[model samples]
Target chain A: MTTMPSFDQWMKAVQAEMEDALLRHLPATQQIPVRLHEAMHYAVLDGGKRVRPLLVHAAGALFDADARELQRAAAAVEMIHAYSLVHDDMPCMDDDALRRGKPTVHVQYDEACALLVGDALQSQAFDVLSSGNLPPERQLAMVRLLAQASGSLGMCGGQAIDLDSVGLQLTLEELERMHQLKTGALLRVSVLLGALAGKALNDDETAALDAYAAATGLAFQVVDDVLDATADSATLGKTAGKDAADNKPTYVSILGLEQSRALAEQLCVDAHRALQPFGEKARRLRELADLIVQRKA
Target chain B: MTTMPSFDQWMKAVQAEMEDALLRHLPATQQIPVRLHEAMHYAVLDGGKRVRPLLVHAAGALFDADARELQRAAAAVEMIHAYSLVHDDMPCMDDDALRRGKPTVHVQYDEACALLVGDALQSQAFDVLSSGNLPPERQLAMVRLLAQASGSLGMCGGQAIDLDSVGLQLTLEELERMHQLKTGALLRVSVLLGALAGKALNDDETAALDAYAAATGLAFQVVDDVLDATADSATLGKTAGKDAADNKPTYVSILGLEQSRALAEQLCVDAHRALQPFGEKARRLRELADLIVQRKA
Candidate 1:
């Protein structure tokens, strides 16, 4: 039997790969506005676990895709994530003073600078995708997928719902719907983009990956909710109890701690089953899904 | 000689063409988020002169390009303009309560909604370009052009400078540099995209179009500054005299009123001369430059 790679080792390898990829793609262009580039580099290079980019790279590696090709896709996804966090922390939105244990963009810079940085980063995501060395058809598909995942029907739309529903008791279904759009959409896109970056997948394989992404995406959120409830600031790397302090709706809030944990475990199992067709090719993805649910931070 | 179209008649023609073109392209797809569509419609259909779209159409017509094929390009440019305006009006930005006498997006809905709408609109501009009937290479080129024009080096960058430089006295050169990126980038893109939408232009024609766009764009801003200083709210259709009130830098602020007016007239003449090769074929463009500098409102 093949020995399982240590989770820490795998994460470290992927993080290095992702960092190299991001740096390779984000060359300082004389034409790019200097301040804009500074802000983008500031937010993107700010330390965080390279989880989304790792998922992308791991999924691509499962199919024996080119590592360098997958790197651009990975960087693009991470850029989107960074941009979302920047905007989410704005005064008008979540009003987060801290992110990843550091002052949030708006707090670190003025609100207007933070806002423009987020806007620039968001636009840069599409810019990188469209301008990167991808075929036109693939570029078009990637743009469309990222747009759907980031726009109203995806991340931004989910944010609107979250803003509207803040401080209100939400049903389990409503919470799931919100999380699906807010987090699940981009997470699924991460996997979908990886598959697209690799060789084309048959309908069955695509469906299986979709199922896996869907389950794991929700499981990731459940774990986040659980951590938010249980973990302290140092461990979580952000304000631990802000959700509850703000009276925000969460899976744990709606389903109780035990129930939420149970749901997460169930989803992880479903995710593993979804990867069954890929056999050993998807072993890393399976482990990643489990790690997501089991994560304490 | 064909009687020159009256200004009102010309505007009505452009408005009808813009509406028809937008509707033709905006298919009723269930997949598209309804709220996004509503926001796009709200901003696009909000009354304005449609000058950007007009410039696209007129520039294409000068090359005898198919009017039908140019519609998508026209709509795409307008959408970018509209989205920029929405974001520019946010509380953290210009904080304008009204745009063209109607409540700004943030005032009409909320800051979150307005931000999302702007994001959607910006992404949708790319979507239209990518999914339109243009060749893949052409679409890719258009996407790059639009991204560069709308991105940090272009409109957004311009806005950032404007925000940062507020209340500080600016030199004429500095002011011109700001407007070049802000308004002139899109204006140049308007004409270049028109040429790209038509049969591709040779280097000479492309260079001339750039010159035309730059001169006319600067003239447009000079006239705007002049109007802000002299016009009333009723005629301007939005807050007037607010620029001087805020101590915002403008051409009239940096140069005296007479010098500013002289600069605008000189730019208009340069704009007309840039189209000399096309001559009467660009009569409408020449008329537009004159009208922009001479308009009371």
Candidate 2:
């Protein structure tokens, strides 16, 4: 706690902490309905970029949030992210056979188990979020935020839009709205949940964080679109150029690869600008914005 | 209410109130991702007996809970119930085309839409439950209650067990455990949610309600087993006698129809005895127990 850990060390620490947090929070595989619990473990553990948890921890650092509280918040958001990925990969949806360099839940287990695992994980997210040292009111607020981000008007709503937009041309405004709900909502909530774990924000602080989150959230997807178009399967970890292959609308598809890359950069600038009021307190959040835009995958 | 409306009238009134409440609480069709929202409405509205809501209202009556809070709780539980049915009817699960005499969500919409609808509706359940006149602590408690009943250790876990048990003979104890987690959990929570809306209960009161709910909850499935064996599709409003065809174990499959009927009767007696502490305040609960055990469908 004397000198700061390097950025890579800090991120690895956060990721490692979340690995333990998610494992401890998830229902034990030893529980009855062992297969389902095991699959829940399978779907959540040892997977994904852990980007959502990273944001939670970084935003939490701004206000010096309680360590255990931040861990729970980060795990809860990651669970929501994980469950969405599980459902989105179902045969009736994306039909993907792989995720995180491993067979997808529906492919590894059966589709029914995948469905149940996703449903149960979503429940587990709320269960974990509503527990712990936070005041009851805070717990209720956290639950509300998680539900609103996950519900019809948020991530699921965004996915429905994405599903319908397949092979169709969407205007930039429409695509932005879709991404805002689909991917942006959860990303933004990760920051808010992190901050909430420490203390409620005043209006100006809330507005600043929202602006930063909005910029970084969109930047994350913009980078994703760019990586999908420009990177190889080996680099990206999933299929490369799949959006264009599937004829799904994406920033790269709509804006072209060059313009999509430019948009991501612009979003990064906006995110950095939004944190000027916080100065040094916003270091992790600032670095995260850059990482989101500049990541190769 | 002053004159004490007849039980039939009271039941109708509660149903009417719930229909309106659900309509108001569910996301509107005009929302973006309109199809998903519309399907959510279709899955929840104008379907099945409002047995869970009835239990919520009945339990709320014991504590004279706020009517509006009870409505939110009732709708929340019903949404949870509705989502479970939607997912359970998918091709990967029970694969039923018909539910409550209408095409199932997956059949009416596409399977993907049904999946999203179920996921969104589950989030909506928490959204609605956590938003009302109740204190924040109460809302958090209710959310926790709903999640426990709906998550791996609850409804979904029961389903995984059911999926594994198909075509296999189950012992009576195993069958009871499955049913307890499956339908019993939600039904029991309906009563608990109702009572929770009134105010927190003392240990004795909670025990009384739990005993009553546990008995009636099991009796519900027992009667369902009996009816599935004897009732026609039209009488049941869905396919009947399909359980045996599917090789799923039920109370009547292990015990004779006569014994299942006798068990239902015994449960009804237990339910009634459990309500003795509340005397006149328990009238709706008492009637609900008889309704559950004696209903033809």
Candidate 3:
């Protein structure tokens, strides 16, 4: 048999697929409120690592899920991520001027358009996921899962905690809890939804996948904190050292750079261990875990 | 048989039920990001006419739909409405200080909190609808319908047109098209979703309901423009005449007050005519059309 494609090859292909799918799913910029649609396209296209969609594709591959359905789920999750970024970078939130190595949505567009883009993107995400090749029941589950993941109890809740924790010292437990809800929830859901787009996993298999997702999710945040501290803005594609500048609590702030790096590595190890049951089928997931903890930006 | 409740009594009951359902659906303030939850509660509760919910209940009553399912649908639509109002009143949008006769969300809370409240409330609305007593497929349909109604093609799109049209002259057709998507889309969905919570309607019945919703929806906006010109801020429970102040085009601006009032009456008549198929079952809806056209606030 031919050798398996490298992780980089896999990522390149999936990224292309995701970009195309997102373009197809987004309203044409020529539509009414052309500016809003243009802003939405600007916010989502030609930007950022498609990490969420990659995780979705990687997990779905094991089950040989329907490709079209997988694309819908992948697009939906990435849309959520994009909308969150758009809103988070608003003047009322992080107030960042740059993202994905370009002007942020609110900076390139106006604040009102940024706000509407976020809102419209979110509604479109749900709209895309609600109807696809999947069974109606499964689609409903996807909607419920995504709604919960993005809502107050998940990413939004985590954001609230993050905002409140600013300028305040947070314990390791508190920081992890906040990250778990904020980034971790959506990341985990990405994997689960990817898996869901295919054959239903047995309870044990789903549990293992959930464990892998949770560990890698946290690891992703830990590395993010480390990068925010260590990387330059050009390399990171976002404002560097923003956490420290804003007095926001981060892993590096609480544990220092060296210890935070160690923690990310440990979490990656935990993520890999959680995938032991899947063995070779989870090779991609394993590679992703390593990539998350070791990326330069 | 006991006489059916009067329109006033029916309104009182549905309003109370909707209030209770909204409270039940909102996140408890004890949760983390308590402030966001508090703001969400403040934005939704003890405010507004609950007109959307009333329409939902009235339409559901026609089909003898499940009360619990209808309650969820009603609450979801109202939550969407509330969130839109919150976002629209933000500094970047309308910059209004009063809504529903009290401080707007951005005024009561900070702009950031107001933003988050709108986002979270929207998520919660979908969450509430996704797992209600209805079948999974129906729930999926509700999710899809609401998503379409609220997304860029609908309310958000209309708002964008509104924002863009400021200081620009929009023809009567363009203004009508904008209102159809903005207010009309949600109003139509409110009735459609309520009817959907019960047995599905045949095409003719669905078409009739859609026409009723469309006409009544436009009539609602027409009356709103008239009231905005005639009523004071205190009486209107919002910053009245702000449409003129902002130089936004309206029915009053395009058709003149007399013509607009005439249009409202004509639409009300059309709404009543569309309900003949439902006969006495549509009495509440018939009363609602009259109430909507005649209400001062």
lDDT of 1 at B148: 75
- Find the candidate with the highest DockQ and give its number: 2
Q: Write the per-residue lDDT of candidate 1 for residues B1-297, one digit (tens) a residue.
A: 898787568767877988988766553434444555566577768478888888887787687777776788888788889888888888888888878888888888778778877876676676676676667767777777887788777888888888877889888888999999889999899888877887667889988999999999999999999999999988988889988987899998889799999999999999988999987878777877887888888
- The lDDT of each candidate is 0.81, 0.92, 0.91
Listed per model, the TM-scores of chain A against the true chain A are 0.94, 0.98, 0.98
Q: Which segments of candidate 1 are over 4 A away from where they belong?
A: A1-7, A24-34, B1-11, B20-40, B63-69, B279-283
lDDT of 3 by residue, B30-96 (tens): 9877888888899999998999999998899788999999999999999999999999999999999
| 10 residues in a row with least lDDT, candidate 3 chain B | B131-140
DockQ comparisons of all candidates to the true complex: 0.47, 0.88, 0.79
Worst 10-residue lDDT window for candidate 1 chain A reads A24-33
**DockQ score for candidate 1:** 0.47
Per-residue lDDT tens digits for candidate 2, residues A1-297, read 598888888999998998999999999999999999999999999987799999999999898999999999999889989999999999999988767778899999999999999999998988888886788887788789889999999999999999999988899999999999999999989999998898887899889998999999999998898888888977776778788888999888788888888988999999999999988878989998988888987
Is candidate 1 or 2 superior in lDDT?
2
TM-score of each: 0.92, 0.99, 0.98
Candidate 3 segments whose C-alpha is farther than 4 A from its true place? none
Candidate 3 clashes between residue pairs 3 or more apart in a chain or in different chains = none
